[model samples]
Target: MKELSKRTAGFTDSVIRRMTRISNKYGAVNLSQGFPDFDPPKEILSRLAEVTKEDFHQYSITWGAQNFREALAAKQSHFMGRKIDPDSEIVVTCGSTEAMMAAMMSVTNPGDKVIVFSPFYENYGADTILSGAEPIYVPLIPPEFSFDTDALEAAFRQNPKAIILCNPSNPCGKVFTYDELKIIADLAEKYDTFVITDEVYEHIVYEPFKHVYFAGLPNMWERTISCSSLSKTYSVTGWRLGYVIAPPVIIDTVKKVHDFLTVGAAAPLQEAAVTGLNFGDDYYANLQKKYSEKRKLFLDGLDTLDIPHTVPQGAYYILLDISEFGYDSDLEFCEVLARDVGVGAVPGSSFFKEPENRYVRVHFAKKNETLNEALNRLADMRKKIAVKK
Candidate 1:
């Protein structure tokens, strides 16, 4: 071959997914990926069964099925505190992955620069590259995962086309607060930059933290593209149902990008997921309660093991600081963890643009039994994987 696609020459298989394979190869409890080990809501499951016989097996409208969009708009409008016109504002995609890609492609040109927070979900890095946008990485300083004001404005000064915001951020689990969102909104308005948000974990927030929708911020509806999924909220990662909600002008372009990219999200899954979108606030409250318990269970185990970790405010992920283990690479530590310690985690370095290598990310989006088993296996870390002096 003369040359493979030069754009992808540097791309590697996703480390999060790679760790899932390693975990399976070693018969370890897989906490490397964020999918729930438990089942989705029974209502959604029941609806899915009914949809099989209802001819939703074929495609719906390429943008989305009418009923699904109406339900989604109602649900989202309630939470976003604004009216959302389903017909003009939404473009359903194969998943938030495609939703984000469509948004990026719709907003960016080949030489555009987009701001990406370091230690973001790995896909954002690939999304910017695939969209032909250069990424300007600003660090969300560790510990609290807070960004400095000057650093953010400095990135804005680069005249970027857009910025990717991962609310309840992955790998670091930092939920952006209202004041922080205001700062971002002000800068975005000042710089005339757009914001593309990944909000798959919006409902998985913990106590004392909240997920503020960027589109709901002042004067942001026009410049914000909200990309989210039914994956985390409904625990249906395989369903591949996600969407982009934006102003009609932007949604028009994103709809075109989405149509050429994947046409639409799964018809049957979208129909089934409507049960979840219409679920009352009680469901979300219960979800928070369940995840809060899991977070406590896992964090307490880490504490007993004397491991230092970042206490997340939202999302189900935890970043275990492994510096004391004295490993040269987080990747090596993760390998030994899966092989010898019987647990799996993503090497933290994979998610960072900085030279970071002392952390590994794991998730607790599993059943109590699964989380307990992973925690039990993790108790062996000190005995099994210490570095030699």
Candidate 2:
């Protein structure tokens, strides 16, 4: 009968998950939650089947399984352009969700300020609140989703404890350029602030854009806590395998936080995903090619229907403009879109700190046939839902 947790009292169910439920209710093609409809790599799947019969049933190390850490360190070091010590520099988490939460808790105290970009993944907001950190939201301007240097520096001047960086950002899919990242690095160094990154979409970048690892920047290795996951890369969101890559000191705290939080990521799943972590470069190259094709197919279909959208530079998400629909709330529009147009979307408002409602976010991570079906249903959108005057 006592008051429930004040930190989470205002929270509603995740709009992304809510829309997926709505999609199921209406028998719509669910594009709201960003999970692939296709299967994971045959190699990993084959290994997973083999592992169930093996001796990975019990819990592994509290921080991570030994072989999983080694494989992840090797894979990440190759791309991140540095040697990552599997023993001291990593804490495998339940997912990037727990990775971010643990990172937030590790670095921040109650009432400490953490800079977060507007139009962020919804979890960033919740993570800050749950960690007892105050969020300083700086807008990532719409359409291009770029932030101004002056505004970011101004946020830095507030003496925040840390900043949350989402490279190949969700919803908007803006891959932060090296120059942009340099500015952030400079500010972080000048302000003596920590940089906690969500690099979940690190491998999913498109052509002409690249994922620059924040910790790889000069003088940033000690101050950066890089949180990422195997979920997106391996198409195994349900497996919940993610980790924090930071300096030994920071990771020491993260390991403690992680141990108390989830004890460890699923032992068998981590063992299975180690197969994916050890995959050759050819696998990543093929993944890039496959996502590129899907992006083109989906965006081109939207263009053919004259549906206005923001093209993603990295991730599989697209933000569709619905300004002409005249709906006061994008949430209502998304529900109607699911019920009538037979496609699901998350209201853009859920991702933005600002009062925004002119767009809804959909993903192209489904199979080609699934995307085509969604596109076909979307072609009848205007006719299906009358535009209010």
Candidate 3:
């Protein structure tokens, strides 16, 4: 038989998902994946129940359901500081996963180059490969997770087709400030590059740190493809409701790609999530408050245990420094940690283009009880997880 697609031949199962499985096998507290352990908003859930009895079972429009798109546009426009036309600027996808894939497919041709910041979410690498694009990884310097303007400009000099920007970045949790974003905007304008953003954690930002929409930048709307989802915001990862927001010409192409990708996001789920999109500012304020509490509770526990970790400015993830544990491979250390320390984490190596092994990514998007349980188990970290012999 012919070999499988070479594009995927080197692919391994997702490190994050693999760590979740290890957590399960050992009954460890699973903080490896970024999903919330708590329930989604009751309002959305209630609407979902009612929708089951309604006529939303059949597929909605291929681009998106009309009401869902309108709701999303209104909600996003209020925050993005632009009036988004739902009809011309949206393509509903199977979550940010498909939104990103569709965006890449729409903008890039084979052998095109895309700028990706290193220590990014692992999926960006796969997305570029699958889209037949080469990735130019610019490192997001650790400890501060800031980028050098010179390095970024050099990447842009490569005449890349696009850049993948994760605002409240995963693994490192760096929120791109307005100044940083402006630098990116300048480079993108200078090089005529598209910016594909993953802004899933937009609403989960902490105090003093704000999420600025990339598309809101001066003259950026035409060159920006904003990909986001209700997964992180509404705690509905399984619902798979995400969208690409861009100018009509770009979105026209994305709609065609999306139509051929997953048909459309689940119709009933889209209808139900509309309730969440219509939620008031107070709902978002309360959501930020809840995540702030979780971040404090979890990070304070790490401090109490004397574990060195990066304090996230926006997202729910914290990168725990494990260098003192004397592990050469972060992956093996994560496996041993799940087996012995009763906690699960994604090896930091998976998210970096560099050979980094000093940290592991863990999330705090859980119920208070679950976070407490994980903390309790983590208290015995040194006693259980030992250095390599």
List TM-scores for all candidates, in order. 0.99, 0.99, 0.99
Residues 87-177, candidate 3, lDDT per residue (tens digit)? 9998999999999999999999999999999999999999999999999999999788999999999999999999999989997889999
* Model 2's TM-score against the true structure: 0.99
What is the TM-score of candidate 3? 0.99
Worst lDDT 10-window in candidate 3 = 380-389
Angstrom error at residue 249, model 3: 0.3
lDDT of 2 by residue, 163-236 (tens): 99999999899999999999999999999999999999999999998889999999999899999999999999
Better of 1 and 2 by lDDT: 2
CA lDDT of every candidate:
0.93, 0.95, 0.94
**Candidate 2, poorest ten consecutive residues by summed lDDT:** 256-265
What are the root-mean-square deviations of the candidates from the true structure over C-alphas? Answer: 0.8, 0.7, 0.8
Write model 1 residue lDDT over 1-389, tens digit each, in one string.
59777778779999999999999999999999889888999999999999889988888999999999999999999988999999999988999999999999999999899999999999998999987889999999989999999999999999999999999899798999999999999999999999999999999899888889999998999999999998999899999999999999999999899989987778989899999999999999999999999999999988998889999999999999998888888898999999998999999999999999889999999998998898888887888987746
Look at candidate 3 and tell me the lDDT of residue 54: 96
